[model samples]
Structure formats: C-alpha cells, structure tokens
Target: MRLLGIDYGDKYTGLAISDAKPSLAVAKDIVYGKTRQDLSKYMQEIITQEGIDVVVVGMPLGLDGQPTQQTKKTAKFVEWLRTVLSVPVEVMDERMTTGAFRAEHKGSARPQRDDAQAARILLQNYIDRHYDNHR
Candidate 1:
C-alpha cells in the first residue's frame, strides 16, 4: 500500500509519498495559498492519482511530548482531512523533523524545500517503524 505523509504548516504544507510496497518515502511537493477546502480537494486528487491508501500527518508536539499550539492546528487539519478523504488518516510525532533535515543539509540554500524534506524524514521514520510489523 502506498502512504502519503504530510507536514502541515500555517502558510506552507509539505507532502511526501511512499513507494507501492511502502518501504520508502520521498518528498513529493509543497502546497501553498489554498483554503482548507481547496487543499482537501487537492489532496483527494493526489490520493487518487498516486493510489495512496493511507495518510500520515506530522503532529508537532513539544519536546516534552505535550500538545503545543501548533499541535492543535495540526490536529484540526488532520481532522479536516479525515472527514474529506476516503482513506485512513493517522498522526505521528514530528518533533525535530525539520531540525534534523536542516542539520543534515547544513549550508544548503534550499530553505524553501525544507518542508518537503521534513515530510520525507517524518514519513521515512513512520515507514521504518511500521513496515516490519506489517510485513
């Protein structure tokens, strides 16, 4: 099954997709300047086009594992997605996902792509953790 991963942000949203076997996840794209309704519609299109069976959204929790304001916003976005999409939607902790990507790149000038890379890392972690169990 293919899985789609999302890093939800206020202004920009990053997207990633898993392979057909779902063993690997890669950066897909970044979406911006869309209303929530429009975004959901766009996601539905992506789901259909990419044959996504599941969606995993990154939940931005505090380092203490407590919900932060951004967590609340992410939850709302996830809820919205769940309501609109036919596939199952799940959440995974995304603490330090962006930082990890940034640290790896270090001096790279591709700040705009950080969100997509972060989503890639987040999805890769999820795949690594669950792929074995599912197999």
Candidate 2:
C-alpha cells in the first residue's frame, strides 16, 4: 500500500509519501492554501496522481496527552478528507516532529523544507510502529 503523510496547518500543510512497498517516507511538498477546501482539493489531486491507498496525518497533541486546539483542527481536516477521498485516513502522534526538524536543521534560518521534514518524521515513525507490528 502506498501511503501519504500530512502535516496539516492553517496556512501551510506539508506532505510526504511512501512507495507501494510502504517502506520509507520521503518528503514531498508543502501546500499553501487560503481555506481548508482548497487544501483538500489539492491533496485529492496528489492522492490520485500518487495512487495513495492511505493517508497518515500528524496529530499535534499536547505533551500532557490531551487534545489541543490544533489537534481538534487536524481531526476536522481528517474527517473532511475521509468524506471526499476513498483512502483510509489515520492519525499519528506528532508532538515533537517540529522540534525534531529544528534539531536536524539547527543552523538554518527558517528552512522552507522544515514542513516536509516534519511530515517525513511523523510518517516514518508511523510506518515503523504499525508496519513492524503487522509484520
């Protein structure tokens, strides 16, 4: 199964992808949108072109293990995506993905690639955890 990873945000959303083998997650693109509808349509096109069977969206939960405002927003986006797309949507914890990205690019001045990197980190983590369990 091919997988797509999403780092959903209000202004910019990052995307990553996995091969049909569902092996490694690779950074794809960062999508900018004025509204959720625009982002959803753009993601749908990517899913069709990439033949994505599943989508793993990063859920930014609080360190206290509670849902934050951003988490609620991501959930809404996931729900909307499920309605419009046929692919199965999943959530993966992304509490530290941004911090991890910053650690990786410590010297950079706001790297434009950070978003995609965050997506890759979350997606790879999910793939490793879930796929390993299944195998």
Candidate 3:
C-alpha cells in the first residue's frame, strides 16, 4: 500500500510519499500559493500518477489538543479533499511535527525543505503507529 502525506499550510503545502511497502516516508515536493481547488486537483494528479492508496494530512491543533483557527482551516481543507478525491483521506495529529523538523535541522533548516520534512515526520509517525499496532 502506498500513502501520501500532506502538510497543509497557508502559503505553501508540503508533500511526502511512502515507498511501495509503505515503510518509509520521503519528502516529495512543496506546492506554493495554490487555491484550494487547484491544490486538490494537483493532489488528484499525484494520486493517479503515484498510485496512492491513502492520503494522510497533518492536522494542526493547539498544544493542549484543542482546535485552533489553523485547525479549523485544516479541517476545511480535509473536507474539501474528501469531496474530490477517490481515495480515503485521513488526518494525523501534527503537533510538534514542525518542531521536530526544526530540532533536527537547527540552523540548516529552510522553509520549503522544513515543510517537506515536517510532512515526512508526520507520515513516518503514522506509518510507525500503524505497523506497531498491527504487529
């Protein structure tokens, strides 16, 4: 099973893809300044091209697990994705995903690269949890 991970942001969205075995997540690309419809369409193209089985989006929430404005925006995006995509769209808690990337990269971090890395972390976390539970 293949999976696509998305780190949705206001200006730029990051994307990641899992290997065919769905074991490792790799940073794919960063999409900048796209409308919601355009983004969804782009995702659809990727879904078809990559043969993705599922899409995992990073769900932004407050540190206390409460929904914030960003969380609401992400929810709206997820909802929009569900309406347009054929495959299942799921969200994984993305708390500290960016922090994790920043901590690892430190001074070397670039905004575009960091976003993709954050998506990679989020996807890898989901893959790990899923495999661990199944095992």
Candidate 4:
C-alpha cells in the first residue's frame, strides 16, 4: 500500500510520497496553505489525484516529548483531514526530525522540501515499526 506523508504548516504544507516498495519516502510537492482558499483547493486536489491509501502526518513533539504550538495545529489538521479523507490518518512522532534535517543539510536549504522530507521520515519510521510488525 502506498502512504502519503504531510508536513502541516500554517503557511505551506509539504507533501511526500512513499516509494514503490514503500521502503523509501521522498519529497513530492509543496502546497500553499497560507490562505483558506489555497488550503482548501490544494489539499482537495492532492487527495483526489494521489489515490492515497494512508496518510501520515508529522507531529512536532518537543525535545522533552511535549507537544508544541505547531504540534497542536498539526493535530487539528489531522482531525479535519479525517473528515475529508476516506482512509485512515495517522500521527507519527516527528521529534528532532526537522532540526536534524536542517543540521544535516546545513547551508543548503529548502524549508518546505525539508519539512515534507521530515514528514516522510516520520511516516517511514512508523511504517517500519508498526506496519511491518503485522506482516
């Protein structure tokens, strides 16, 4: 099954797609969500065209394992997503993923892309830990 990863943000939402074997996840696109109109159409189009089976959203839990402001926003977005998407929406721990990505990539920057990549990492981790466990 193919999984879609989403990095929910106030201004933009980063999108990523799981590889064919579902072993790798890669950045696909960035959707502008800074405005209500943009947010509505962008996400609707993605769900329509992607044929997504599972949606994994990144949760920015702090270093101490506490939810941050963005974490709450992400959670709310996930909740709203559930009402729209027929498939299940899962929240994955995204602690340190974004920061680590920034540090690793250093000078080179693609915040939106990196955000989506972070989502992919979160989803990949969840898939490896839980989905594979059922097999």
Candidate 1 structure lDDT: 0.91
lDDT of 3 by residue, 11-130 (tens): 989999998887899999989899998999999999999999999999999999999999999999999899999899999999999999888877874664578888999999999988
- Which pairs in model 2 have colliding backbones? none
Relative to the true structure, candidate 4 has a C-alpha RMSD (angstroms) of 3.1
User: Residue by residue across 24-133, what tens digits does model 4's lDDT show?
Assistant: 77777776646645664665676667766788888878889988898888888888878867678888887877776687788876664576767666667767876554
Residue runs of model 1 more than 4 Å from their true location after superposition: 133-135
In model 4, which range of ten residues has the least summed lDDT? 32-41
Candidates 3 and 4, the one with greater lDDT: 3
TM-score of each: 0.93, 0.89, 0.92, 0.79
Which is the better candidate, 1 or 2, if ranked by TM-score? 1
> Each model's RMSD to truth, in Å?
1.9, 2.3, 2.0, 3.1
Clashing pairs in 1: none
Query: Candidate 2 residues 21-80, lDDT tens each?
Result: 777899999987648777777778988999998999999999998999999999998888
Candidate that scores best on TM-score? 1
Model 3 regions more than 4 Å off? 107-113, 132-135
Instruction: Estimate every model's Cα lDDT from 0 to 1.
Output: 0.91, 0.87, 0.92, 0.74
